[model samples]
Target: MAEMLYQRDVYGKALVELGKKNKDIVVFDADLSGSTRTSFFAKEFPERFFNFGVAEQNMMAAATGLASCGKTVFVSTFAIFAAGRAWDQVRNSVAYSGYNVKIVATHAGISVGPDGASHQALEDIALMQAIPKMNIIVPCDGPQTREAVIACIDIKGAFYIRLGRPKVPTVENKGKFEFGKAQVITKGDDVTIIACGIMVNEALAAAENLAKNGIKVRVINVHTIRPLDNDTILKAACETRGIVICEEHTVIGGLASSVQEVVAENNPVKVLCLGIKNRFGQSGSPSELLKEYNLTSFDIEEAVKKVIS
Candidate 1:
């Protein structure tokens, strides 16, 4: 873990970078241009930017139309509305058609803080996971967010990127970003910690703490969830005695479920998870919410120990 940065802040700038490269790149926002940072693209290319004034469904439908005409459409809005409110269009029009639309949703998970449960999107991943032809990317920090932004442009199909509002510790991952590949941050034999988004940093911290106790913990950053890097995941499950899956979303249908399904069918290792346990988020500071939901490094450290035991 290193400097703190917001993935959405990096995403806003990355859109401008992509716009300058491709003339057919269009951006759509649900009146959250400033918050979601599609305003960066809005500023650079106002002619290509469209604001739907709070209608996420309309924005998604219009984006689908643009994509059908061979335009690479990038849509932005809060995570809740981007995945929940406009899901019909996202599923029926965008995903069902298999267009080149990228839904870069910000303010995801319970870390939106004082926004309360109404704004928090604990089920965004699950909702998108239910849809077909939708690639999901949960970048750990700003650099990876930029990497994902550039990589998704060539990927033919719809993509849902989940980004949070608050600044999170940067988890350093070696090598260039590859789509649908997992980065093993550390090598361990006792246990493996598979995580995404801000949880990557927590996994790293937990690995460091466990090291002092003479435990070898391998940490994996699975940025792309849709086409999950099953080879790396299965390798980790085979090399380690146990595995711990971590994410900021719900445990039911999110990262944990995905890893468990693969492991159960393949190697079948003892697994533990750190995430929301079937409940809504409440208004609180980001740090408080993380601890309240048992998503801190300390919680991960404990889980690793318990898994090993």
Candidate 2:
């Protein structure tokens, strides 16, 4: 099969489509508009675009104000700044007030590459998932990122959509996925690989490679980090003897963390968590960083065999 195109253009294209449909839709950026692809919306609707410089807190407050007034506001920035810089505004103004503002944060995880630990957002998912009334989403690829942006407008509450700096493989088609719904990319009985964000592609590739060695693997897309699809995870875990979770985020409080939460309460099974193992990122390309952090497809395949062995 031919490989699908991978680029951040999916997000840019989705913003353009949404901007054309809804007049209440607005975008706010914290000096990283070009990087986050919110600049695409700004291009068409310059009147509705607001650049908040580097003041992420003010941008958060402004987005909350827009949401309160019935406007679907999208706040864009790097994941590090979105969570680390404006976390107070997000928790107090957005989550505490229960605003409908969408936090479309990008450049998440070790995939950030080149920027190092200061810019990489390894712990963002854990921090945001702990907040009350916050909807957490980690889209697998660009197409899913576009879907995530469109879905954030309909969901009424504080939302965090984690995006990456790298262009990931498009394993899913538009409108074929949804929020709080897990996508089972592949099915098997030996082990289930529940993943989200960029790791979805990695898990799928790992599954294909594992099949050559006679290991059966199931791949699932756990897109919604908060309000996680517990039923799908539990079902997959119960059917498969073991589970392997893959993500571009830290293993502490991301897809793997959510999977563990469900498996611990419902089913007892052997689980292998694949991600950054409690370490900060360094400057390099996305692929280099993933390999350095042991988040490559080979690593995932090896992890599955280890758990089964």
Candidate 3:
């Protein structure tokens, strides 16, 4: 595995670099800058950093106001607070108006660990996906997260960039990021595994394990959830024997649902979604929670086998 780096730190550092180049860039955090690593931007651009002190809704609204006034606003908070608690503001104040506000939410999924179910945002993607004109990006690793942050600056309208708390393995550093494109990490014909966020690393490990057993699998990193790579997904479905989706989020409206929608409409194929099945998270270590929720590489391998069977 490559050297582990926290996604939040990468995003924070990237924001600092962006700020140095663009005077219009401003950052807002809901009293969790330290945890979300937005403090890096705050430290360098103190005048542009606005700490909202736990008021996520107000922070989102304020972000909209700043964006309206020609500021490239980046808002940071826990995923739960950003997507759940501030949904109204995000929808009405940002997405509805097509504002250039980037919502970089950290601590998403069960990886939030000891913070428990309340903090873990298993349904954040679903919530954000439901809103019109809401662009969603779930970076797979540190490098991808940094690239995504930079990409968001150029993308117009409201954007939601989901990030994790733990130091996940850096999976993709060589590939260039496109807003609606999926990267084919490995090519195969027997099965295709579509994954995003930290689960992309797990999917890669699962593919390696399956290869040992003579099961060829294709691994695709679907970092962009909304405006999904429909062409790539359809091509994988048509070429591969079956498809599997692995995510650290709920199966309802995440990458699994997005891929299934594409396959069903274009070319029907068997799909096994490996993720939290209509359940909430709990307090535990990151590893312990992942094991308990069956989100490890072994689980992804099993799902692939099931889909191919």
Candidate 4:
């Protein structure tokens, strides 16, 4: 088994690494520094971190203010608060004029487990995507989370990076992470399985299983959803018989919608989306939640077969 690492575990250390190099890099947390792992950066640069207790809107607004001062600011909190509570502020303040504020929200999707529906941020990506120019990146595991954090140092304008609460198994990914490029893990012509975040690992497992059963499957890891990597995704759609999009988010307005829009506009292929199907999350263990939501590797395998059929 691959060594499991919490996706947010390396986040603090990565922020600290950036803090060491950049004096103008500041961070804002809405009383979730510990959970978001921004505490490491706070401990490293005490003067550069600020905590606004339970005021995500204020925290986001202040983060934009710092960005206006030509500082690269990062705002951290639960995804529900960052994308739900501070949405108006995030849209009008941060994304309006393309301010350099990175909103890295932790505990996204049903993987949040006992945090339940109230705290789960299944709609975060959809909300962030509503604002034009808000970059979205959902790193699948710890290693990619580190890469995403470090890459945000130079990424201009507003960004929405989604991270989960529990430890995630590192999936097979080759080469350095390019901001807008999708990593094609395995190449096949029968079908393409494109996924982001924790679902990437499940997609890989499904692909491997399908390969064993003599069904060729292509796996594409789309860490950056905003930029969408149309080139790579379109290429896969053109080459493959069908497409299966997997996300730990809602099927309506997240990865599934984005891919469908792109493919429909360009090539119009048979696509099946395996994700949370228009239902709020409920409390359970991470594994149990994944199984209940039908987001496991077995689900992806079934979705792939359906798309091909």
Question: Please, what are the lDDT tens digits per residue for candidate 3 over residues 1-309?
Answer: 487999999998999999999999999998999999899999999999999997999999989998999999999999999999999999999999988999999999999999899989999999999999899999999989988999888878999999999998888543888888999999799999999999888889999999999999999999999889998999999899999888899999888888898899889989888889989999999999999999999998888888877
Off by over 4 Å in 4: none
Itemize residue pairs with steric clashes in candidate 3: none
lDDT of candidate 1 over 1-309, digit per residue (tens): 288888888999999988998999999998999999999999999999999998999999899999999999999999999999999999999999998999999999989999899999999999999998799999988889999989999999999999999998776655678999999889899999999998998899899999999999999999899999999999999999999999999998889999999999999999999999989999999999999999999999999999989
* Root-mean-square deviation (CA) per prediction: 0.9, 1.6, 0.9, 0.9
TM-score of each: 0.98, 0.96, 0.98, 0.98
Query: Which ranking of candidates, highest lDDT first?
Result: 1, 3, 4, 2
User: What is the alpha-carbon lDDT of model 2 when measured against the actual structure?
Assistant: 0.85
Error of 1 at 181 (Å): 0.6
TM-score of 3: 0.98
Q: Could you tell me which 10 consecutive residues in candidate 3 have the lowest summed lDDT?
A: 168-177
Query: Which runs in model 2 stand beyond 4 Å of their true positions?
Result: 1-7, 172-175
The regions of model 3 sitting more than 4 angstroms off are 172-174
Per-residue lDDT of model 2, residues 197-232, tens digit only: 878878888999999888888889888988888888
Better-scoring candidate (TM-score), 2 or 3? 3
What is the lDDT of every predicted structure here? 0.93, 0.85, 0.92, 0.91
Which residue pairs collide, candidate 2?
A: 114-284
Model 2 scores a TM of 0.96
| Candidate 1 lDDT (Cα, 0 to 1) | 0.93
